[model samples]
Each structure stands twice: as C-alpha cells, then as structure tokens.
Target: MTADKKSITALIIDDDQMVADMLGQILQDAGLNTIITFDGKSAIKLYLDKKPDIIFSDFLMPEINGVMVLKAIKALNAKIPIVLFTGYYNQLMDELKGEIVKPDRILRKPFIQVEKIHDLIREFFPGYEIDA
Candidate 1:
C-alpha cells in the first residue's frame, strides 16, 4: 500500500546540524517523514533511493553545492519538489535562476517563521491535512 499525501516524505540537505534538525522538527510536526543529509553527494544518493516528495537544501554546502544537487535531482526524473534554501537569497537567486529556478521554491534562510516551511508544503500539496 502507498502512503497518503499528507504523510509525504521530505529530504533536508545541509552541512549544518542545527539547520537539519530544525527542518526535521518542522517537517515532522507537519506530519511528513523527514530524511536528512549533510552534503550534495549524499543528498543525491538518498534522493534517488528514497524518492522523497520534496527536498530542501542549503545553497552553500561545501561539496557538490545546492545547484549541483539540484541538477542531479532533476536528472533523476523523480519529479519531486525541490527548494533551494540559502542565507543569501538575493545574492544567489538572481545568479542561479537561469541555471536552476526550476525548483518548486527558493527560500531565504533564518526562516523568520518556522511554520512557513510547513505552510509552503501545505500550499504546494494542498488537500492534505497536517497533523496537529
């Protein structure tokens, strides 16, 4: 049997443990299973193997960077949503858009409101109810 949309999986890729932990907490609170990795290489491997419903990756990772991860994810044809997350969205989004805006969402770091990520997921995959 397949899992329901509300329980969709999410992959979080970043070298920072705090970022990964926070994202996982937010995603888990929203009812989705969360998978995490610290670099582009691992992100790509897990992405293909697990087939997550969405991915949120830090743009400035050391190895293979977010853009490279995005490229690899795109190549996988997983058709999953990808979010390019960065502390400096203005600096990177403009430069990277032509190369990789194909992502479902480009999010600025420090989230401001932690719930926003869940909100975005709710908006993107509507009709799925988030658990309380």
Candidate 2:
C-alpha cells in the first residue's frame, strides 16, 4: 500500500548543522516531516523513536558517521531507504565496495538539485508527488 505523503517522515543526520537543516527544509517543503540530528549516535536514538520512512545521512560525522548509521538502521529495518551524502563521493564509494551492507542511495554534496530530493521521495513512495 502507498503511504500517505503527509505521514511520511525523513530522518536527516549530519554533523554540519547548516547542511542538515538545509536538507530538512527541502524535505519539509515537499510535505514530509523531518527529524534532524547533528550526530550519528543521537541519530540512532531518533531513528528508533521516530521510525522514519527514509534517511539522509552525511558520510563523515564526528562520532558515529553515516556508514554506522546505515548499518544500524539497516539492521533495525532493512526495508527502509537510506541515502548517504558526501562531498567525497568517490572515496566513500571505494570504501563501500567491500561492505556487505550499504546505503540504498548516495547523494553528492551541496544538495544543489532540489528535484533530486523530491524525486527520491516519489520513487520510494509512489503516492508522494512534490512539484519541482
């Protein structure tokens, strides 16, 4: 069954407050609720409590990092979609090559393409339709 667009929640984890907030804003604008955390550790807690439909995490974080978040969340709910964001996309890609568990998607930094974010929600969630 397709979930209601308004009921969808996105978890955003990034050590950089600006980047996290910016991504949260973009998702919020698309009619999804957002829960943002500045650390991967706390993000784990939020993920458990909120049970968000999707996750957007930065590859480099102070304590826990995005890969850790990805593994932890995947363990909890493998069906949930997790998107890893990194400026060093190439390096992260190489790092993930041998890993058994990896993020469902990887987004390049700067978050320049707003439509991409909207498209992700639409792709994962058939009922979600956000204007470009």
Q: What is the TM-score of each candidate against the true structure?
A: 0.88, 0.95
Off by over 4 Å in 1: 1-7
Q: 74, model 2: CA deviation in Å? A: 0.3
Worst 10 residues of 1 by lDDT: 93-102
lDDT of each: 0.82, 0.90
Tens-place lDDT digits, model 2, residues 26-131: 9988889999999999999999898999999999988788998899999999999999999999889887988999998899998789998888888899876774
Q: Which stretches of candidate 2 lie over 4 Å from their true place?
A: none
Q: Candidate 1: give the clashing pairs.
A: none
Highest-TM-score candidate: 2
Judge candidate 1 at residue 108 and give its lDDT: 86
RMSD of each: 2.6, 1.2
lDDT of 1 by residue, 1-132 (tens): 444755599999999999889888988887889899999999988987898888999988896988888888887774778888899777676667567436778888887686678678777687767774
Could you give me the TM-score of model 1 versus the true structure?
0.88
Supply the global lDDT for candidate 2.
0.90
